[model samples]
Target chain A: MLFVFTYAQQKGTAKNPFILNPTDSTVVWGSYWSEMPPVLHIHSGDYVRVRTVLTSNPEHLIKAGVPANQIEKQLIAVQAVKDRGPGGHVLTGPVFIEEAAPGDVLEVHIDSIDLPIDYGYNGIGQGGFLSDEIFDRKTKIIHLDREKMLGHFADGIEIPLHPFFGSMGVAPPKKAGRWNSAPPWIHGGNLDNKELVTGTSLYLPVFVKGALFEIGDGHAAQGDGEVDITAIETSLIGKLHFIVHKGKSLQWPRAESATHIITMGFDRDLNAATHIAVRQMIDYLMQTKKLSEADAYMLCSVAADVVITELVDGNVGVHVMLPKYIFVSH
Target chain B: MLFVFTYAQQKGTAKNPFILNPTDSTVVWGSYWSEMPPVLHIHSGDYVRVRTVLTSNPEHLIKAGVPANQIEKQLIAVQAVKDRGPGGHVLTGPVFIEEAAPGDVLEVHIDSIDLPIDYGYNGIGQGGFLSDEIFDRKTKIIHLDREKMLGHFADGIEIPLHPFFGSMGVAPPKKAGRWNSAPPWIHGGNLDNKELVTGTSLYLPVFVKGALFEIGDGHAAQGDGEVDITAIETSLIGKLHFIVHKGKSLQWPRAESATHIITMGFDRDLNAATHIAVRQMIDYLMQTKKLSEADAYMLCSVAADVVITELVDGNVGVHVMLPKYIFVSH
Candidate 1:
């Protein structure tokens, strides 16, 4: 498949006149640029593949069973090095779009995440929300054995692994700037949704023409809130396909798997995040299923639920759940 | 089955003093005044029968479903009359337990929730969280059909029903007085956990000698944050069974089901709430499992998740999740 990509070089300046803020929108594209859009349109079962550069090059790892303290020097050694300049987080254009648009929702089907075992557990501290505390003083660099498939806990509790990308967003609008890689906007950049796992279809709002989207910052595994900041941060190869729904507009992103309809809301405060989540779910019910406000509020209380998507991330996010089985769509 | 109950009446005062401020070791004996304790145990199939009173029984649902203009008339009607003090939250508790003590954990298994149809929906005035300005000026009395589920949304989203208890706790262990039954304390009062549904196993930290636990404030349905400040308030008949696990000191209450382990932490601030949740989960892993501190932290980052259990309730509460399928004991 021909995957389109827009490379933002460090020395290059924004051709567009709009000042890109880190919060509002996440992507900027000029009309005169020759490179293709980031979004890829494909069929449900189509297999799409793309590779990404490491956030930091010269990434190091500890051999299996090594003491954690030994890696202290290695972290200090690599903290200041900028490997590929600022030209990171490039997007693979709308590769598979049978039907997608601004008013419509785009469902991305993620299949498998391929990891390169060479630099297994390196490049985790690239400066995000919790990077200073977790990577600087707390955790250790470790490798994951494909066989063990277990996470370490204090008592005897073993954690499981479910990995996905950190930043995956479509271009905002033709007018919005190629925004910073910090906040999540309409086009769905830096969403950091944990449920974007295998067999999940993420429904994103399409703002720009052709939904110029991109997906990178692959994580091996991450907990909700990403409190320690960095997950199993590593370069990964992801295979997925996309389907777009035209003439539809979603206020925010929605995720659906075998379980429920997930409505995502990210904000600075927990309550604000909660409000966004509740409001969107209420709105979803109103528009998609046709319920009144009072009924919608009640439904949210009963069937719909609110979840703290991430509390420790720079921005706390709350997700509202609407179990699909409860209300079947006609 | 004869469920052993301890009924306590104040000797000089009208109300039970134990229900207000519970001591870490004495409140249990206070809530229950009967002789020897029986098997205060409840398992999966057993149903626990509980008698509950109204939240504002003295206040009454005076102007329910009444327009804003009629509220004055409704209050005037009540002014001429006085509440004989029979309708407010009448908890049949201080249940006597033989094996529960401070540092012990009480496991309450919810079997079923039964609600009254007509008198279910409670009304909130304009000053509450979801003020009348946000909602409507009139008192909206939501009627629930016990036979059939009820939920509302704006568009067409139909909601399913899942009923639960809003205020279920062992009284506070610090101070003594007529404490406002609004916030959650060390004993877990007013902790509106929506997931406290059937098939859920809830674990509360035992503070007093016999665990002076009183459960009431049944809600037909409620969202996670309970942002509107009120749930589908109703008088409920709860069928629950209790089991006591000794020699365990959990800092907060915990809940478990077939799929996940929920550890709860309550605090006044969101940050503090999150810390309580994280610390409690860490404590759980440490006490139950055999992992180290760093490993536990990593495990939390990779597997354990924190949730905003009750945000609007006096103190913001967080529920950390430990998925069960990943770590099961043989």
Candidate 2:
């Protein structure tokens, strides 16, 4: 028998200790702000269930002929919130983790991400990445098959879905001022890395007290580079477990899945970004795999795959993926 | 029960028509030159069994403790070629093809790449891809298990091998002057794309008469970026089928395997290069799959992957890979 499950009901069973809803007024719409108040405060090693709305306006979706019944009610309510963004994404929260301060790392374990709807949209704009090459704006509505775990694109084409949050970050350093939720930076907002699906843990450096962590921009499926500037943009409910590492600090976002360790680098210059990713990967191998710096560097060339995360993001992203299977011991 | 086999005996049947060896004095060392005379000439749709030596000096290999017996006699003799280049790669040839001229496309189908030796080397120099990040120069000899199709990296590490020619291209336009083999331009030299393995076909724009096609810099295996500037550098004997497409013209190199169609872009500006790749991919999908430009662009975002081919190439390379499976009809 088919049954509907609510986030509250899922959390009531004690599977999730804290649940943060996007409907809360404290939600930061469009941009990340260090000065924004925390919506919820929790300690290290706490499991928080969070929800996110697609980075789009309900009116736009309806205008594009999306069925009214399929429109998310929470998203409709979120549009009425007075406090919004200086940017474009409807970010969920800057949930604070107690004792998370500078010189520490906030490790986020993505437990699960579920699509609340059976449809999503992909948009391409004239001013987006590759705009010079493709000078046109377009949007596409895609149907998602939950059971098949696929996004039906055309008559015979289907995209295998691997849902993940496009944006996940702690607040920027206090002096960085308000940040747009588009270009990913040291703070890790809008990473748009398709590989950070379920079973992955994202590690971001803590810049301020309590590590105001935020998450949003859900994508049902995406290829590397997010070439057309969007994926299957859809609303999502996710469960994340946060742990603050006291002595550990990171310069950029790092992630690990069941089989691969991921290191990311972002900069306006792709070469510089690539360098950052390779250097970060070398550091990871040296620290975790206990390889010499030279060996790590050489191993990166022979083993690790450096992929373009996204070119659309103002700061282009590059990520190095090192398969864990290559390591003999662990 | 194991019997020794020679290349000639292996091709005893009427399968391959020409087998070109590298020991011939007609090899082009280091740089690609339009003036370099063709070593061999064949008509369109001809099969060539070409052999390439690893890009290293025999003296250097011996100094690195590679067993003298393991060094191929052809490589030792190739080092004596006086007409070397301003670069460092020991490329095999400028095999001319009849009826191939400027404005036409040369299709090189890679049938097979076999490693003649059981070992390979990976080197990291001071001026390669991640040179700024890694200042030291080092090289490591890796053991290859041909039967297992893997490169043994260390005690607990094994690298799966997918051998390919790192440098494959036709002569650049005669007016461009002598071109260094390092940067991949419109003529497609030193692409270093790991996906161009066996069963793949690489299409290049012909810039001159006979399309002086050259191929070398064999790699046992490589990651996407070739981050440390080298893969498991090794000698390879590959069989290639050349076909001339007089009606089809291309602005850049394109490739297709059994499952994926590949488009490449090269520029000093990675972003521009990426844009070129995305544009080319969209164009390809529209032309081959009968999709509209808008649909193809969106399809690329949802299904295709853009990978960093290499950053060290003077003109950074980006390639868009669209899985052919997306199309229902072959």
Candidate 3:
């Protein structure tokens, strides 16, 4: 069974007391949100659904098929949109998991992504990486059809759309502070893994009680670094399932697919991030292949690899991979 | 015919400068470096053989099949092995191509890589991203086998081996200046593309006469960023064949192979780096698909993607590609 949470209409604090911080743990639970706090009970195989919001001003809306020119006008009219309310990613969960705990890795399996027509950000603006010289206009409004599987830039160019969430994190440790959605930490936030699409299993470190997890910031598509500072920001209704492993201390996050073993690295500098990724992979290698640390490091330098995760985000993330064919035990 | 260059000796001078500098145009004529430079006078479709060096302190050495204690003793005996010396990354160039000229991108198709036995290093120390906490001892020592492939850690961990040049650049423009061989620039220095193995076609931007290109600093393998600030630095003997195109203006370097459309991005910031990469790919996409600029840009954001090129080597580079299956000419 899958649980779906849509922020259709929000009530008062009496209904929802869980302030949506990426690192916040569940305290007073109410029925304001769709999924309740700290208990996503499921068997070895069960499907779950998650809904997310956009990172733009809620009061603003771009009707279907709005041209780039008029979109500029609307953006200029609402330059100070942030003054109206709290400015940050607001997650909608703490989906209680009956069988999650510290030292164990929570496996989140994503199934599908559904986006409504009235959802998703629609614009091409300046100040992005390419905006340095390419963007001439203030805004290029985009109003894509809900069924549009691809977006067009010019007459002959077509792009395939792959939508996924930009933010997904479990509650931090018992003592972990309130976390923002800007960076990726042990609990996992803003992990923009492209493969996190349909049919991928993500393993995250569980720190807090019951793993009060939340996910949001859905993106239609985003590059490795989200270099433009924004991907096709969109609201998404996603179906996901969960399986909890008890008493497994994951120093960091691990992801597995049919083809690869990916360890996500989060840090401020690229070198440091890459080191963490490489070391973690080495640990995996040691456990599976029975090699020494020196050999693992050498393997990383020669065979395994490091890839940049996201550079445009506040904190940098890197990914290190150990191809699946090498590990025979699995 | 193919050309190979091996530095029998080192002679640094203004006209024949040894190091590569970005601002300097004189040292721009080179591409990809193994142990030394390839010999001058390479022709299209010709195979070229080259040599490489390892990052070891010349002052240290160890016998074949030495015991672990002996290896440890050698490592503790020496320090300061990171520096390679003034006569570093020598190149072979100015082959005087009949059809090559300014503005065209020279394509270097890598053939194969082979290593010599009795390989060793000076202090495989702690300096990479994980140095702060896990500070391993540094030392210089030699190994018994030149064909050393893997380094063991504990159990279940084994790494693969892939080697390539760390430095590759074209001859400096006729304008004149000395150069440094640390960063990759318009001339493509220290590109370190792992895909640059045998059967890969690398396109280098030509800025001067004869494209007097050169290559050096070969490593068995390296992660995306070379994040530890160093790879498995080693001396090597490699082979390469060159083909030059005349009168074609390529803003940057590009590569193509049977399964990949490799566009390289080098910049100070990740955002700019991604923009450059996506822009080049957009250009490629437009040229191949007959799409306008707008369409190409949109396609890039949606279909084409960013891959971490090298984050550790002074500058950050990204590779963006659109799988061939995603687009086919109508």
Candidate 4:
């Protein structure tokens, strides 16, 4: 797998980008470790066309009503690897960003996300918020109307598709060792925030050398809490533009979409997460919009929308979305 | 004060709504009690053009940067309300919905919400999410651009207005004496869910005879979480059409907007509130959409957006929003 990696460490441009395919060697099963060797190397401002595969069992897909022929061959091909999880996702890469270092911020612009397959699965099982009441462990195959970007959940139920990667992060600090990929931390793994779709820029604090970036857990569409445990799980292809901001610092992950500035916090306690998210937004507003601490607090109360990013992620997520239109000159 | 109420019971139509003003006779300060005398008795499907008053001091409004002349006189007049709270709002009515009874549901259709004042205030005090960190309690009066439907928070900050009644509901169960008008219960007071704007139907469970309803704490605009403790608080006039669903029942407050179906949960713990909201949505999808228990839970995971309605309201609010468009047949 390392033989297929682009290790030249040359500057990659928009026109000529490094393409990565989801293979057993390039993908890790259910863990984000600082020791994971870099699969590819690219310079700042370079674009990477990355492909990701789902982690669910291929036999389960057929049981869930997906035809055998429709399954992505890469997903079936990658399943033979014996390595699996302390978590449950087959994430692609620990792509090394050459100039990135600790204490800096790595900004990843999610340029586009397109479905690689025309079907996805939603499973309900134990370990969700309603795990006590709902004991049925089953999966349903949802046919994706890729052209229209809708999921046919049932005859009458059609879910709108907003495809995005559920996990995107760099390796944690060396001391943290192989971090379980279930909970998101300051390094930004398994965020499960649906707002980081195409056109959004996710800013994560670089925790180690090369800012070992990784991405996977494709969700065609997902609700805020991901309360039932999974989203419309499927394979996806995304064009990510990576840029490392030298000397810049971020305590937690922050994202900015075209319409709003979003700050996120992940913790077992939702209120503690909310406090972190709100404080981040206040800090953002104080720095960029140039408002006082009090004014920023007041502005967030009156203007920002705080949403549950995902409740089931070990460290449940809370995000504060502050609209950018409000910051315009009169 | 009692003599000013419209004692004659009557049916109100869309063309001829019974007008209820915000005088001491019609408004109750800070409580939702079953024993509170009904100010107006209206039949099912009655339209009430209700006028509401702000609860803040006029002197504070002036201190918050509003011109003294712009302050609504009704707000100043309502200050004599000595029968104040276990909460702080001065709300209008315990208006009797004639056919409503225990086990029934009172469906209040918010037909229209119009700003009656040109200015609103956002005050950050001692009880907010960051109250411990922010000690300076202050208020800022924001200018409302009624024509453009914006609130000028500052020179460059303009908040879009989505007017709503922060507190709205019937009396609690007769056994539960006068309840504080702060935390929302199954009776639905101070939901602070910003999505309950115009063109929405709020279905609240009826706990007492007549389902004595009240409304107040007009917010010109408010974000989710209401972190700093208030929105753009001001006076508003709303056109409310009340219909009593006699045979229907609801466990918690459920609402439907033009675009989505909403379910709410309130608790001091946000996670508990989230559990309640998701379960309510699951129940809702199961009952209305006729999906099996398993499917409903799965559907919520893949489609519903759980949002924080308000964090400062003693019992923090969490609501699940399921888009209505997804429920239609192909």
DockQ of each: 0.30, 0.58, 0.21, 0.81
| DockQ leader | 4
Tens-digit lDDT track for model 1 on B196-231?
A: 887787888776666656766767766676655666
lDDT of each: 0.57, 0.86, 0.57, 0.90
**In candidate 2, which residue pairs get closer than 3 Å at backbone N, Cα or C atoms, i.e. clash?**
none
Candidate 3 per-residue C-alpha lDDT over B224-304 given as tens digits, one digit per residue, 9 for 90 to 100: 655444565655656666678765677777877667787888886655676678788878867877775654554454455
Interface quality of candidate 3 as DockQ: 0.21
Model 1 per-residue lDDT at B144: 60
Please give the distance, in angstroms, between residue B164's alpha carbon in candidate 1 and its true position after superposition: 3.4
- Candidate 1, which CAPRI tier? acceptable
CA lDDT, candidate 4, residue A148: 90
Positional deviation of residue A117's Cα in model 3 after best superposition, in angstroms? 7.1
Task: Write the number of the candidate with greater lDDT, choosing between 2 and 3.
Answer: 2
Q: What does the lDDT read for residue B301 in candidate 3?
A: 48
In model 4, the runs with Cα more than 4 Å from the true position are: A1-9, B1-9
Could you give candidate 2's per-residue lDDT for residues B1-330 as a string of tens digits? 999875432221128458888974757887777777898888887888889999987777887769888899989889788876677887878988888999999999998889998889988876567676566788788999999988988888889899999999999999877788888989998999999999999999998899999999999988888877889999999999988999898999999998899999999887778888988898887887888888888888888888888877778889998877656532
- Here, model 3's chain A TM-score works out at 0.73
Taking the true A–B contacts (Cα pairs closer than 8 Å), what share appears in each candidate? Answer: 0.44, 0.72, 0.29, 0.90
What's the true lDDT of residue B294 in model 3? 54
Q: What's the lDDT for residue A254 in model 1? A: 78
lDDT by residue (tens digit), candidate 4, A67-90: 889878888877876787778888
